[model samples]
Target: MSIAKTLAALVVVAALAGAGITAPPTATAAEASPPRAQAGEEVFYHVFFRSFRDSDGDRIGDLRGLTERLDYLEDLGITSILLTPLQPSPFYHNYFPTDFETIEPKYGTLDDYFAFVRGAHARGLKVYLDQEIQYVGEGHPWWTRSQGFAGAPFADFLLWRDAARTEAEPFLDRATWPHYDGRQIGIAMIDLNNPRVRDYFTRVLLFWADPHGDGSGRDGVDGYRIDHMMDDLDHKGVATDLFAGFWRPVFEALRARRPDFRILAEQADWGFGEDWLVRGDADLVFAFPLRGALIDLDKDKIVQAVRETEAITQADKGQIVFLENHDTDRFMSLIDDDPARARAAAALSLLLRGEPLLYYGQELGMRGITREDGMSDSNHIPLREAMRWSAELDAPGAAIWYRGDKPWWTEPANRAHDGVSVEEQQGDADSLLAWYRTLLALRQARPELRGGDQRLPCGDASEVLCVLRESGDARSLLLVNLGDAEARPALDATIADDRWIDLIDGGTVDPSTLSLAPMTVRILGTP
Candidate 1:
C-alpha cells in the first residue's frame, strides 16, 4: 500500500477503536482504553533497534521486525516508543549519521519505516525518533566535501580548528576514528552557529515530524529525543550558548508546526538538567541524578535526589525516569541480579511523579556491563546485546547481531537457559517480567500514579523510601524497602483515613502498621 493510503486506513481504524467500535482483534486490553491525552502520563519504552528483534534471517533487527512486535509493547502497557537513531551510519549504534535524510539500509527502506509508524499508531502508541544532528560521520556528504576544499559547497557546515580548514575540532577526544568498515574517518561536529547548518537540520527534523507533509502525522514520528544535547557544543568555545540561540529556535519551529510535539533532551553534562528544561525549551530530560541514586540503592541518596529534582523541575515539565539506557550498564547487572531489588526499582520508576522509560529487555532482567577492551565502537557490544526472546539465544525473533563477532556474548548474563527470556518468564507469576507487568498495569489504572504530586513520607526510616502520590481526591502511597532487612517505616498520621487498600495484592491494611520485606514494594491507598 502507498504511504498515504496506509496512513488513512490507520486513522480510520484508530477512530473506530477510540469509539469502542470495530476494534482490531489483535489489540490487547491496554489498547482498548483511550489514549493518554497528556505527554506526562505516557510510559515510554526505549528501543535499540539493532538488538530488539529480527524478522528476516539476516540476524539484524529491522523496522518490519519491530512492526511485527507491536502487540508485545501494547501488552506491556507502553504508550510510546523512543527509538535510537535510524539514519544511515558506519557505526553499530548509529549515533553519528552519514546521512540525515535516509533510513539505514540494513534496517529497511522508507516504506518499511512508514509501516512501523502506522502500525504503532493503530495500537495507540506514539513513536519518537532519536536525532544526533550535532555531528556527522566522515562519509557524510557535508564532511566528505569539506575535507580538503577551501571553498567547498558545505565548507562552513563543520567546525574547523585551523585556518586552512584541514582539521576538524574534536568533541569527545579525537576527531578521527576507524569506521565499522575498517576505514579511518573524521567525526566532524556540526557548526550550530552557522545559519545555513541550523536551517538544514531544522528541515531534517521537520521532514521526520511529518514525512508525507499532509500534516496528519499518521505516518510520521510524534516527537524527537535530542541525543547528547549540549549548550556550548563540547565546550570548544565555538557554537556557545546553544540552548538560547540554536536549540530554542529549532524547538520553536517544531512546536509551531505541531503544537503537542514533545522534545526529550539528553543533557551532555548529565546534571539535574534544569537549565536544559528551562533555557533549551525541552519538555523532558533524563533523570541522571535519580538514576544514580536508584542504582546505588541508598535510601538517603534517593530521597535527597528526589527532593532536589522536585525543587528545580517545573510542574509542567517532566523527567524521563529510568534505570538503564543504551549507554549505561543494565540494571540487573548493577544490582547483582537481585530479583527483589529489581522489583522495587520497577515500582519506584512507574509510581514516581514523572513519565517512566523502560529500556528494551529491561523487563526480562537482562544483564550487561560496559567492556574495558578498548575505545572502539565494539567496546559497547556487551551493553547493547540482543534482546532475549527465547531460551535459545539464536531463536527466530532474537536479533543476535553480534553473536560470534564479540567475545562478550559468552558472559553469564547472555548465557542460554538463564531464565531471562520472555518465553521463560511468560507463565511464571513470581518472575521479574511479571513484576514489571503488574506495576505497569497499576500505573495505567491509577491516575494518581501517572501525574500526581510526590511526597516523601518515610520519616527517619533509613532503609525505606516512601512516596505519597496525590491527584486531588485520588491518593496512593508507594513504600519500597531498599535495604536487605525488613523495614517498618513510620508514616505520617494524616496519610490515611480509616482503612487503606493494597493496590497490588488487593487487601485492606492500616498505614501506621505497615511493614515491608527486604527489597519489596507495597502500594497502599484508601479503600
Candidate 2:
C-alpha cells in the first residue's frame, strides 16, 4: 500500500477508537450532555501562595488565601489553577523540595492543601501542582545519610563534585554554591538511575494523587508543570534518551488513571529549536520565544524568533505565550515602564495563537527587576504588589489589581496615570486594563484567533511584519510594525479585495495603505 493510504488508514482507526466504535461496531446511544471544553478554551491563574495577603499580615500565602480567590478566578472564567509547589521546601519559590509528599508548613497543612483542592474542584476548577524535581538542596535527607543514597546505581542520581580530578572537567564549587541561604541547602539530588529513586518518586506522586494508596485514594492531580527541565539530570540530555526512558513511564501511569492529565515543562530554551513540546514529555511547553520577541529591543530579531518558533512546533502544539511570568523581570519594566507598550504587548498576546499567561500585576503595569544583591530574596522581586482598594485615594478600586504600597523594587509614583490599579481601568473603555479585557473577549469570540491557519503577508519592505490568520469561517490580519516609523504597505496590488475586511478601522479593505506606528500592532478581521 502507498504511504499516504497507510497513514489515512491509521487515522481512521484512531478516530474510530476515539469514537468508541469498535471493530465489531458496537455503538452506545449518545447521552445528552454539554461538550467538554476544547483545548485552549480554559484560562489559568498563576498564583504566588506566599505573596497573597488578607486582613492579617502573616507574610505567608496559605491554602485559605488560594481558596478565597477561587471565586474571583471562576468569575474571570479561569478553569484551572496552576499552583506553584505546595511541597515542603526551604526556599520561597519552592524549587528546593525537601519532602515531596507533605505540604509546606509555611503555606498550609496537608488538610489545608486538600481543602483548597476540594474547593477548586467544587467550583469546577482543575488543580495542577508545579513539580520542581530537577535539583534538590544538598541537605536532603537522602544525601546526608549513607544508606539514604544507597539504593540506586552509581548513575541514577546527581552528585555535587567537591573538587575536580582533572583540569578539563566540570565541577560544582561545594563551598560557595548549593546554598540558598547560610543554611546547608540540604537538598540532596536524587539519583534517578537507582531503581530505588524511581520507586520513591513514584510513591511520592501516588501518595498525593493515588486515592487508593490509603485504602481509597480520592483523586489524583489533574496536571503538573515540571520545572528546570533544561538542567541535565541523571546524565539524560535535554533532547535525548533520558526523558524517553525515565520520565515517560511516570507520565504514562498518571495518564492511565486520568486521561485528561496535562503536563507543562519549564524548559525555557526548548521552544528555541527542540521538538519536546509534542515529543511525549509534556502536553505544553512555555513559549519563551514569544516572551523574548515581545520584550527584546532588537526589532528584526524579534520577528525572526517568532517566525522560527512557529515553523518548528506542530499545529496542535500546546504552548503558553506570555509577556511576563513569575521569575522574569516584569514586562512593564522591560518596556521602559511604558504602559502603552505594555498594553500593546498584552493585546498582541491575546490575539495571537496559543495559551497566554498574564503575571499577576501585568494588567496594572507593575514595574520591578532583580536587584544586584547576594541575598536570593533581595534579587527576586515580588510581582504581586498590594491591592489598592480605596477610591478616595483617587485610585480605581475595581479597575485592575495594583500594588498599593511600593514593592521591594522601583514602583510607579502616579498610580492614577500609569494604570497601576485595577479599579481605575475597570470602567474606562480607553484604559489599558479595558483593552486587555476586550482583547481576551475577542479571543473567546473568534475561534480563528484561538487556533487558526496563520500566514505572514508579504510586505513591500523588509522591515515590515505582516501576518494573516484564517480558520473556517473566521479570518484576521495582524500587521505589526517593529521599526520606528509609520509603515505604509501598498495593499491595493497585494491582496484579493473581496476576501478580506478590516475590523479595527470600520471594515477597511486590503490593498490600501497599512499604517503601522512604531512598535505598534494592528488587527484586521473580515466583516
Candidate 3:
C-alpha cells in the first residue's frame, strides 16, 4: 500500500531478473483520465464457494463469509464474480442438486443468499451463478419417486430405459441411463427432450434471475454460467440434438425478460465450440488453445493463438481466457516461484484480446494441479485448497475442512513459510499481487490496452513478443521478454512520439530504445 515499499519490491524484481535497477516515475494520477474503451477491460473473479471465506467459525465457506469479503474483491477491481452452484445437494461440491429451489443449509438460508446478492450489487459487482442442469442427485425426489414401481408420476423427468412405449418413457427409451457413479456423486441425467423437464429448469433459471415474480426488481443474479453444455442433451449420451430446439428457446425466453443478460457455457470440447457455442446461444466459452500456449511459454504458439483468438472473438461472442481454476492445474505450478515466469504469463493473459479472468487465490500465486495417477476426483483436491490468509496452515482464514479429502499426491503450491500469503504480500508492492493490481489498474486507465485492435509487431521471435493495441486517438504497446536473455522488440511502423509511460513499472520510457529484462512485461503508452 505504500509507494516506498513498491519501489523496493521492483528493485527486488530487478535483482531477480539480474538487471540494473532503473526506477520509473511512480504513476500518481493514473485515474486522472478515463479510458476511451467503455468499462475499459473489466475482469471476473471466479470463487469456488467451499474454498472461499467462512463465517460462524464453521471451517467452511458460506454466503455470509463471502459477503464479509466484498471489500477484498472490490479492492482487486473485479467487475464480476462467478460463483459455483449453491443449490442443495448431497455432495460436498453441490453440483448434482437434490433440490433446485432451495439454498443449501450449510451455505446458509435463502435469506443469506438474497443478502449476498444485494451486497454484491451494491458494490457494482455483477454476480453470475453457476448451474448444473444436466443431472440430479440420487436423493432428488425426481430420482426417488421415478425409480419406484406402480407408475412413477415424475418418471418422465429422467432418462430411464424401459420396455413399455409409454409417454413416461425416456426420450432414449432404447438406451439405459448412464452409470451414476463418481466420487461424492451417483446421479441420474435429466431428460432435456421432455417438455415438462425443460420447463422445470426454465423456471429454476427465471427464479434465480428474478426471485420475486412481482415487478419489485430485487434479489436476482445478473446472469448464469451453464455447466457441461452440449448440442445433444440426449439420454445416456445418445444424440437427441435438442440444444438448438430446446436451448435457443430457453435463452430467447429469458432475454425477452432481461435483454442484456449474459450466458456462458462450459463447452468441455472447446475445439468445436468456436462454431458450436454460438449456435447454442452461449455468449462466452473457454479459450483452451491460447491458454495451452501460455502455460508452456511457447511464444510462437502464442502469436498464432492471438491470431486465432482474434478470428473467433466477435462483438456478440468471445472467449474467456484463464490460467488457474478449480478444475485445472494452478498457473503457479508452471511458475515454480519464479517472478519472471509469473509476470510474463500474466502480461500475456491480461493483454491478450479476450475477456480476462482470475481464480480467487491466483493473485497470491497459489499453485496446484490435479494429476492422472489412476485416481479420480481426489486429484482436484490440491487445486481447490483453502486461501492463504497468513502463513499458519491452521490460521483463522484457512478453511482446511476439505483438506482432509486431499489425495496422497496432493501438494500445496505454496506454504505460509513461502511468504505467498496475502498478509505477507500485502506489505510488498512488488509482490505478485501488487503487480496484478498495477496490471488491472493499467487496463482501466488505458482504453487501447482493453479495446484496441491487437497485432503482434515482433514476427516469430523465440523469446520476445510484442502486441500492438490501437484505437482511434489511443495507442499502447505490450512487450514481454519470455526468454532467459534480454530481448528488444521493434515496431514495424515508427513511433513519432518518443516519450512513453510505463504503466506497470511506474516509469518513463522511449520506445525506440526500450529493452526488456528476462521475464519482464512492459505496457507503454504514448506521451
Candidate 4:
C-alpha cells in the first residue's frame, strides 16, 4: 500500500475508534485501550551526517546520503531523527557556525535539505535540526564586520571584553581558532542579552520550522535540538540568567508561530535539566544522570535515577534517554564489549520512562572512544567514525571521511569481519541489531511501555532492577539482571497474583517464579 493510503486508513480507523465503533470483541472490561500519543513515546535516532552515509562518494556523509537511508530508519522503528548541525561551520562537527541560514557546501544545497525533510515526513518520521546559535566563528559576517569597525551595523552582535573590540570574550580558554580556510579566526559568544540577537535567532528558527512561510511545515523541519543550552552562558558572568530574558522569549515566539514545534535542550552542565523544561519552556531535556547510571549497571543507582527522572519530568514534557551519543564513548567500550551487557543496556534504554535516543551504529555494537592527539579536530574523529555497512567495511554507501593517514581509521572500531556490520547482523537472530529491532517492535506493540508511568519494584533484590510500567488499565513488568551471575528475584505479592505473558519469548509464565539470566532483560505483561 502507498504511504498516503496507509495514513488515510489509519486516520479513518482512529476516527471510528473514537466514536466507539471499533474494538476487538474479546477485549475485557479491565483491558486498556491504546494509549494516546505522548512526547515520551517517540523513539529518536541521533545521526551525525558527516559519519552516517556518503552518496556522492566524496568520503563525507551528506543530506542526500541521509535521505537514502530513511527506509532503514523507518524499518528500524524510530519515529524521529536528530541530526547534527547542518549549517556552514569552520569545524568538522559543524557546531561553530559561520552561517546559519544556508546548508554546508559539503552536505548539499537548501533544495536537497528540503527534499530530505519531505521524504522523512512522507515516511511518518520527524526531522529535528541541531542548532548551536550561541557562538559564531570568525567567518561569520557579524563577527567580521564587528571587528575593529567602530560604527559597524553588527558591532553589538558579539560580546567583547573591551571597547576597542580587539579581544573577544573568552569561550573557555582561547577566543580564536584556526578556521577551515587555514587562518586563525576569532570565536565570539553571542550577546544573548541583546534583543536583536534574540530576534535574529527567532527568525532563523521559524524559517527552519516553516521554510516556505506557508504554515504547512511539509518541507520544513519538525523540531530543533538546542546544543549546549545554558542560562549562565558558560558561567562567564557576561550573559547571565538568560532563561527568562533570552530563551523564554525566543521559544514563545516560535511556539506562537508553530504551536506543535518541539525544542529539545542539551543542558551545558549535563545535570537533571529540570530547569530547562520548567523555566526555559523546552519540551524535552537530556537524561544525562540516567545515562550515567545505566552505564554503571548498578541497580540502586538505576532505581534512583528513574525516581529522580519521574519526579522532575511533567506529563507533557519528557527526557531523552540513551546509553551513548557522539560526545560519549560507545556503550560496548564502556562495558568491555560484553554482548550480554550490551543487550541488557539496549532493553533499559528503550524500556525506560523517557523518549529513547539510539545513536547511529549503537545497535551494531560499534565501539569507539575519545582519542586525545594534539591535532585539532582529530580527537573526536574516533567516536564519529564511519558507519559499518558491509563485512568488508568498504561498501559503496560507507562514509569513510576520516580514512587515510589518520590514527582514527588505523585503529578504528568498525573492523572488517568483526560481525558488527549491517550485512553480518541482518539475518543473525541473536545479533545486537536484531535485539534492538525486537525491543523496538515490543515497545511499539505495547502502549504501556511507551506512555506508562514507571515504578521501581523488587528493590530488596540488589542484583536485579525491576520496573513496573502502568498506563490506564495496562501494566507490564521489566526485570533486568544487572549482575554477572543468575538472579532469581521475587516480585511483590500484589504484582505476582496475575499470570504474565512473556513479551520477549511469547510464553506464559508466573511472575513470582521469574528467573533472569546474567545480564539479561525479561518483559512480562499481565495475561
| Candidate with maximal TM-score | 1
| Candidate 4 local distance difference test against the native | 0.80
TM-scores, all candidates, are: 0.92, 0.76, 0.85, 0.90
Q: Write the per-residue lDDT of candidate 4 for residues 1-527, one digit (tens) a residue.
A: 21122223232223223222211111122122222234667999999889998999898999999999889998888889999998887788898888776678888865577678767777778889999888887688887877887578988988888899866775666866653234665668989999888877776676677643445554567789999999889888899889999989988877776777889999888999999998888999999999999999888888889888878988788899999889999999888889988988899999978899999999999989877654355666777878887887667878887777556767887688989898999999989999999999989988888888778878665577888888887888888888878787667788888778988788888866767788878889975
Between candidates 1 and 2, name the one with more favorable TM-score: 1
Worst window of 10 by summed lDDT in candidate 3: 13-22
Superposed Cα deviation of residue 236, candidate 2 (Å): 9.8
Query: Model 4: how far is 466 from its true place, Å?
Result: 1.1
Candidate 3 C-alpha lDDT tens digits along 35-76: 212232557799988878778677778889899888888787
Give the CA lDDT, 0 to 100, for residue 20 in model 4. Answer: 20
lDDT per model, in order?
0.81, 0.56, 0.70, 0.80
Clashes of each: 0, 32, 2, 0
By descending lDDT, how would the candidates be arranged? 1, 4, 3, 2
Q: Is candidate 2 or candidate 3 better by TM-score?
A: 3
Which sequence of candidate numbers ranks them by TM-score, best first? 1, 4, 3, 2
Model 1: residues with Cα > 4 Å off, grouped in runs:
1-37, 178-184
> Which residue window of length 10 is worst by lDDT in model 1?
18-27
1-527, model 2: which lDDT tens digit per residue?
21122223233323223222211111121122223235665555666556543323454567776676677665554456777787666665676676555566666655556567666766666777888765565444444443234343332344433322111111222322333243544444544545555555654554445433322224345678787654345333322343665567767766665566677777745455344565546777887877787786344665677677777777655677777766787787777876557766776666666677766556666666665556444355444444333322232222222224533423432243445655556677776666666666666667788777766665445455656668986777766666677776434333546456555546566534556677676677876
- N/CA/C clash count, model 2: 32
**Alpha-carbon runs more than 4 Å astray in model 2:** 1-37, 40-43, 53-56, 75-79, 121-124, 144-184, 206-220, 234-241, 268-275, 278-280, 297-299, 375-377, 382-419, 460-464, 489-496, 499-514
Error of 2 at 90 (Å): 1.2
Report the lDDT of model 3 for residue 16: 16
